[model samples]
Each structure stands twice: as C-alpha cells, then as structure tokens.
Target: MKRRNFLQQTAMAGASLFTAGQSAAATPVYQQPADNPFNLNYAMHDGMFRNSAGADIIDQIKFAYDHGFRSIEDNGMMSRTPELQKKIGDTLQKLGMNMGVFVITSDNWHWKTSLTTGKQEWIDKMMTDCKTAVDVAKRCGAKWMTVVPGNFERSLSFEYQTANVIAALRKASAVLEPHGLVMVLEMLSDNPDLFLRHSDQAYMICKAVNSPACKMLFDMYHMQRNEGDIINNIDKSWEEIGYLQIGDNPGRKEPGTGEMNYKNIFKHIHEKGYKGILGMEHGISQKGQEGEQALIKAYRDADNFL
Candidate 1:
C-alpha cells in the first residue's frame, strides 16, 4: 500500500475508536492507539511536531505523548531556566513519560580543549559542569547527559590523550554516581578532529573509566557513517552502552527516507532486551503537518516488525 494511504487508513481507524459523544477538542489532535503503540521506547525531541503542537515546549511534549511517544529528549536542556525545567519534569511525571539525554557543557570549556587536553583547568571546568548537570538532571528528571571528549590534541600522543580522557571522565563519574545519573560519551563522525569516532573507542574508554556513571551513547546515524556493520558493533559495545539516538544516513532525516533499515535495527535492540530510550534525533523528511504525520507513520511502519 502507498504510505499516504496507510496513514489515512490508520487515522480513520483511530478516529473510529474514540468514545461516543467526545468532542474533537476533547480528543487528542493526533489520532493514535489508546495504549502506547511502539514496542520500544522511542523518544522525540522538542519542536519535532511544532507544526501540529504549536510553539510551547510543554505542549510539544504532550503532543508527542498523544501520538504514542512515551519519552522525550532535549540536547539543550541545561540552558533552559530552572523553572521551565521543573515544569518539564512535572509534566513528564504526570504523563508517565521518561526523560532522555541533555548535553553537558560549561562556559569555560571549548570543544578543542575538552578532556583530550588533560589540562587541570579543563578538567576542573568539566567537574563544575558535572556538578551543575546534577542539579539540572534532578530538576528535569533526566538520567543521562551526552558528553563529548572533544577534538584531539595534535601535540599529545594517542595513549596520552586516551589516558587524559579516562581520568577526566572518572572524576566526572564520581560526582554523578552518587546521584544515580549517567554521562554518556558520544562518538562523532562529522569531523576528523573529533577525539572519539568509533564504537570500539567509546567502549574502551567506558571500560577504562570502570564507573557505572560513565557509559557510551550509540548514535546509529553516526555509527552507520563511521562503520557500516551496525548490528555486530552494537553487540560488541552492548555492555557499556547507556543510551541510543536515531537518524538515517544519506540525508539525516526520518528512517524510511534514508538507507538505514530501522525496522531490523529496532527489532535487534528489542531482542537484546534494551529497555533504554532510542532518541529520534533527526529532521522530518517532509514539511508542516504532513511532515509530522509522515514522521509518525515512518516510525509506526518501522516499529511494526513485531
């Protein structure tokens, strides 16, 4: 069947399920199954469905929930005001939705001088960020924050750089461990200067850190670009992976619009018993409300493998 036809049929089926006498205003704008639809806990970020949900971040979150999304992530969450963060937390708690990752950053740190430099000032700045992240996490009910080790130090040897990063992460881990929060290390494929670029590299760092609070973030889009053999590498890095993000290659848009087969990937993760969130960290393939509907349909199709 055509994608649009399938979506139209599903929408009609969902609309038919509404209770008698319930006005359209009383029903969720996005017609979805009464229960959370997807088998896996796939999370959407803020503004993903803005065309349908309007401008409010909280409304966007509630819109995602109405479409059967059980979790949400915000990379710039730390930059939000504390009052807004608490409201987000309260809203998620009330809706029984889970919060995913936010990036860990501080004013003193730069991408170039990150953990790879091994400089005390940089490490100290990271520690300060970790302390602040704890409070942010508490307010927003986030368990994991993305941590990038930053660009490589050209003057430093590979072993020295790795050691420096491990030492820095260990320190940050100590502060986060007590709070039951985790800092997930992400490997970037966008730049050659990036210190961490492979799953094995992140797995090694996580092993060396040897702290529960220090784990790797397996971003499927980056990994697909960095290494083509996705499933095998996932198994190898499974033990240390704390979070996952999703995007498709070639265009970095919704799954079906790209080359990666998300259905099989999701099935593999589900069979492996992963209860963690897989963040939908990509842009829509289409535009406006049509794009939002298409995005949800794409996930629904991919998640129907069960």
Candidate 2:
C-alpha cells in the first residue's frame, strides 16, 4: 500500500463552536485563522464552511485555506461550467491546495439497468461518462472522481453482476490510466438495494479490475454502518483505498457526535502512514458559524493521536 503522512488538520477554529443562545439569523460571523495543519489531509467540501465564508463558492475555498484545510472536494463539479471549473482549479493552484473526488456517475437510489445487468447500454453509458470524466479531470486538476455503478439488477445473479461491473471498470480504467486519473468506487450504506455496499466487496472489485485507476473510496460513515471494525477494515482494503471520507455515524454529522470513535480512527490512519485526502463528507452538527467551528474543533480533538 502506498502510505503518506499528514499533520493534524484541525484546531484554532476551536473558538467557532460556542455561541450562547445565538439564533441562526443572528449568529455572528467568525473568522478562522490558519493554524497548524493535521498530520493527514482532511479536505473540506464547499458548503461545509459556508457559514464562515458566506454564500460565495470562491470565498469558501479561501476561508477553508485560511483555516487549516489544504484540500477540497466538490461532488457537483461535473455540473459546473468549464469557466467556473478553471477558476476553481486556478484558485486551488494559487493556494497550493489539492483537488479531491467529484462524482463521475451516481445511482438514482432506485432499480435501473446498471452495470450489474451486463447490459450493453449500461456499459456504453459508463464508457461515455468515463471519457467525459477525463476532460473534467484535466480542467479541474482533479485526480480522483467518484464512480457508483448504480443499483443491483434484481433479475441478475450476483456473480454475473460482479463480472459485468469488473468488465465495465476495465474499459473505464483505460480512459483514465493514460491521464493519470483514478475513479474511486464509493460504497454506500444508505440502501440495501445498492450493490457494492461493503469494503471487502470494493477491495475484491478493485483486485478483479486490476488497475491503479480503479481504487476504493473508503467512506468511514458508510463503512461504520455496514461493518463496525473500522481499523481492521481499513487495513484489509488499504491498497485499494485511494481516498477516504469523514462522517460520524447515526447522525451523519462531524466526528465525536456519534458512536464511531473518529479520534482513534484518524490516529490509526495517520500512524499507519496512509496518505490520501480524507473528504469531510458530512454536515455540521450545530447551526451557523458555531456549527462550522465545532466541526473544525471536532477534528482537532480526534486527530490528537500520535
């Protein structure tokens, strides 16, 4: 497994959590000063810091950078105009920040003719999207994009479905391999109807696909719900894990709000030398700038492990 080390990514926003009885409309705007970054790269999403940065997207990026966040993820990047994408890329470059995953394809959370069907139409659709993903990657300077192979086809057997997904991924991998891009498969725990809901399943799929461009995106929140042994599961799928995401289970909010011990989890990943972007994939537990500040401090509390 390729391992990279990061400093703790939270803190200094610790003050943002407290607002004694302040209403959402009356909450005071808080400024986040750059503090020491965490050992690992915890990338903030656009809306995560909107309270501190206002409604402007570009301001959100600067606010995140102003704090300690050096990476950002935007799942909606594909929907953005090319001009906006370039502006974001340029801004990130100016700040020397890294780009993280955006979705290439997503399931409608319903039964559809997915890759699992071994349907030519589904495969063709995926191939078309793969080509588009390459162009988006280039424009945004992003290396990782999310790929969800839709829901399971009730008519198909599991083995046959697996084979179809693997075949489709190989074709997609070819499109990404030349450009040094990766498509990290996300395992969702939101629905049982979805295929690829487990970490081991993603690991097996990556192995079968056998391409560096095809890797696992271990989302801690989903995995915590699907499989509880977070550390062991991470170690099990380490090699295929090209990216990571953050969210406490139960509430799907920031760390420490739920049953999952994010402090230990963050420390474990850091000490193990797993170097990758950990996307802040959840919402803030509190409201307003206070919520955002708590989000930052929550990371600080969790990443304290050596």
Candidate 3:
C-alpha cells in the first residue's frame, strides 16, 4: 500500500483498538517510545524520519516527538504557506515542544555586497525581512532565527566589512528585539569566502550590535571543522551564544558516526546550564528506516553522558 494510505489506515485501526478497550498488543501501529529521554533539548528537522513517518510534515513532527525528541527546527519555515505555518505552531504548542531557528532569508542574501557593502538597499531588505520574520516567529513560536552575513567584499578592508555587518545587524536587531525574538549569527565552514567564518568573529559582531536580539549560533559541526577546540571556543563565546546546532565532524552526520565526541560535548553543555535547543542539523549516516532508527540510537548513546 502507499505510505500515506497505510499511515491513515494504521491510525484508524489504532483508534479503533483503543476505543474497543483492546490490549496494547492487539494494535499493530508503531509504538511510541518514552518522551525526551535525552538531558538536552535536541531539535530534529523535517525529512529526518520520512521513511517511517511518510510525507506529511505533521506526521513527521509527531514521529520525532514520539521518539524522544522535544524540539523541532525547519530552515525553510519562512517559505511555508501561512496556513501551514499556523498549523505547525499550533501542533508544537499542543505537543509542548520547542520551536528552533529558521533562516532569515531573502533574495539579496546571496549577493557578496548584501551586508558587507553597507548598502542601504541591503540593510532595507534585511529590516523588511526581520519584520516579516517577526510574523513568522509568532506563527511558529520560534524565538531564534539564523542570519548569514553573506560573502566578503574583498575590495573593502576587513574592519570596514566588520563595521558594515555590525551596522546591518543592529538595524535587524531593533526590528526583532521589541518582539522578544533573536537572530542568531551562524559561523559556517562551508565557504572560505563567507564573511562570518569563526566563533570569535561572530561574537565580535554580536558585541558590536549589542542587542538582546543579536546573538551567536554556535554550531558544533562548523566549529569543529573550522576550529578544533570546540569546548574552549564555546566557553570563550558562551556569553554571546544564544543557540547551538549539532552534527559530528568529518561526516556531518549524527552523533557516534564521526570523529567528534558528542557525549563529552553534550555533557559539557548540560553542565554549563544551557537550557536552549541544540539543532540536529545533519544528514543521516545510513539509508532508509534502519538509518533513522540508528540515528535515534546514536543520540541516545551520546546523551547517556548525563
């Protein structure tokens, strides 16, 4: 049978069994595990369990929550229809799950001159995007959104570029702060030409912006690839870090599938009293349902450090 049809039939059968006072063993539906077994709030993204949950986004979310995840993040939330966004927000609220960061995106975001040029047009676009983000955040119950300052303008001096980024972010912050939302600056390792490539750089920009809405997203995968001392960098940038993302280095996969020791890192973050969500922003190491199951087991093993 088609996956969606099968899922619908399974749900109906499960409801019938429960209504008939049938024993749990009589139902053939997938059993839910204990909720949130991990000490930290690890946020899973959509498509992470498509093989098991089918194509429906809501079903995928319910699957994640049922399998011991307490948070969810979608990088493309802004592009979703308003109706879908509201449904997502309502569902998350009903499940009592935390909503994590979505990218603060725009058409001009990819241009090298976007933020580093210090152009009014770019800043205007950013401000407009920020205002739009406030609405998106309200619909999805998200407190944090990811911001990338785009590529570097080589013609401009490093100081000038930094100043431009800080100025642009300051404007964006003003738009977000009043609404109790934050734009977390993510330092990526994907492109060397990217202006924000280091933790200290992101921290400096956040400090220069100096607003509650402007903070850093200390992604462990990027930091591990960009700089080896994950724990030390996190400590140094701790004051400015508003969010965290996870992916094992060398493979950019789930915990235990790569070189980085996630257990120790998770333990350290928990010890430091971080109550925020850590986004599971990576690919599954294996394929199909087995891969999804292994991904959960990897997190469970890594989270055992507590």
Candidate 4:
C-alpha cells in the first residue's frame, strides 16, 4: 500500500479510539469568534485533515473551525458507532457549525446492488438502509444524505433503466420525507457506467420523485469531468439542487490545483442565494500541515468571492 494511505488508515484507527471518552455534549474545541470573515457555509472531509492533527476528530473539527470552516462532511457517518455519531453531532451543534451530508446508500456501491435491478431483496435492503440513515441523521442533526443509484444493468433498455431508477428513488423518498430529511442523489462523473451521470438526469429523477426530500448533490469535480459547463449547468438545475461537493478536475486534489474556476463558480452559487454546505471532498495535493493550510487558504480565497 502507498505510505500516505497507510498513514491515513492508522490515524483514523487511532482517532476513532479517542472519541470513545468524549461526551457528546463536551465543549467544542474550535468555535470561531464572531469577527471571522469566512464563517458562512464550508465543510471538512474526515480523511483530508487526519494527517495534520494526529487523527483527533475534535482537533480536526477545531482546526477547521478556527480556520473559518463552518461545516463538516463525513461520508461514513452511518458506519461509526452511535456514541461517536452523537458526539460529532453534539460538537457541531454546540459550536454553531452545520452538519453536512452523510451516506444513505453506501452498500449499493460496496455490494454491487443496483436499484435498477428491480429485485425485491435489493428494494427491501435499501429501505432498511434508509431507516438506518434516518437514525444516524437524527443523531448527527444532519438534514441531507447522499444517495447513489449504482451501475446500469446490462439487461435493461435505457428507458426501462430510467423508469427503474425513478421507482427506487420514489420508494426511498417515502421514508426520508416523513422524517423531514432530504436525500440528495449524487451525480458521479468518476464512474461513467453509473445510472446518474448528469445534472439534467438527476434533476429529472428528483422531479419524478416529486418530493421535497429528493434533490441533487451537484459535485463540481465529477461534473467538470462529465460536462464542462459547471456554472451554466448549476443554473439550469438550480431549483432541484440541494447540496454541493467540491474537488478540482485532473487530480481530484484541492480546489485551486486544477482547471475549474472555483472563485467565479462560488460567486455564482452565492448569487443564487444558496444557503447549504459545500462538501470539501478533495485531497490536499501537497504533504504535511503546510499543504493542509494551503488547502484552507484556497477555500478562503474562493469562498470570499461572496
């Protein structure tokens, strides 16, 4: 394994242990004072800052908050122990920071279960998973959960596949809607074979579901890869988009390291009156604390355009 990946696994293992003793209501370590400039809506990914803080989740949260980040996103929020999830939620709420998106359908990717399969077992498992997501979301005070519909089934026609996806989402929406939680379908450009690849497709699905709880997680990195018109596509799907995720193209690294014009894009999103979190799902291209600091600076520069 690569040294960096090994180090990451080690750090996460250690920090996951440390969170055992901290009370859910413990005072948050990193609350920004009222005077900070960039306190609006930014998120921190768990693995990205592990190297900088020796795997302490609280320390990572504090570090991000002190540096002006007001939100944090953990894709594996449901996988953590209940105590840990409560602790994380308590810290963010106490610190006045928002909790960002967590996963609702992780097993779909892991077990190769496509919603387009139209099998009773897959539908049953997905509903059970949504119930689990609701419990996690309640504990973490999270309002948005990420959903991926999985790969396209080779046996199905394109139109049939679309209909199958819509049916699955509509069923998922039933559970999420009653709990006042929204499930944002992520359009991943990373996998071309996935059912949902474009903003328009996602928008169509969201409309088909016809629930306030169904929306799109418009990821800039993947969108930039799948389609080039980032700003315009966002505007076109503005009404249906519920959340945003960030990573620059070419490297999947920090925001400023690639070709996307984040400043202008952020400005456009801000102009549209978006009040949700932007999940910082990219990696720091450089090594050590300095590299992490550089990533922080990049967000500040891009976010300040507002």
The candidate scoring highest on lDDT is 1
The alpha-carbon deviation from the true structure for residue 243 of candidate 3, after best TM-score superposition, in angstroms, is 0.6
lDDT of each: 0.83, 0.79, 0.82, 0.77
All candidates in order of lDDT, best leading: 1, 3, 2, 4
Return the TM-score for candidate 2, rounded to 2 decimals.
Answer: 0.88
Q: In model 4, what lDDT does residue 256 have?
A: 80
Poorest 10 consecutive residues by lDDT, candidate 1:
1-10
Clash count list over all predictions? 0, 9, 0, 0
Global Cα lDDT for candidate 3:
0.82
lDDT of 2 by residue, 198-280 (tens): 99899999999999999999999889889889999999899899999988889777899999988888889988887789998
lDDT of 4 at 80: 83
Please write out the lDDT profile of model 4 over residues 89-138, one tens digit for every residue.
99999888989998786543522647878777777777888889999998
TM-score quality measure for candidate 4: 0.88
Cα RMSD to the true fold for all candidates: 7.5, 6.7, 7.1, 5.1
- Segments in model 4 whose C-alpha atoms lie over 4 Å from true places: 1-34, 37-40, 106-113
Q: Per-candidate TM vs. native?
A: 0.90, 0.88, 0.89, 0.88
Report residue 158 deviation for candidate 4 (angstroms): 1.2
For candidate 2, give the lDDT.
Answer: 0.79
Q: What is the lDDT, from 0 to 100, of the residue 48 in candidate 3?
A: 77
Model 2 regions lying over 4 Å from their true place: 1-35, 106-111
Give the per-residue lDDT digits (tens) of candidate 3, residues 157-208: 9999999999899888889999999999988887678888899999989888
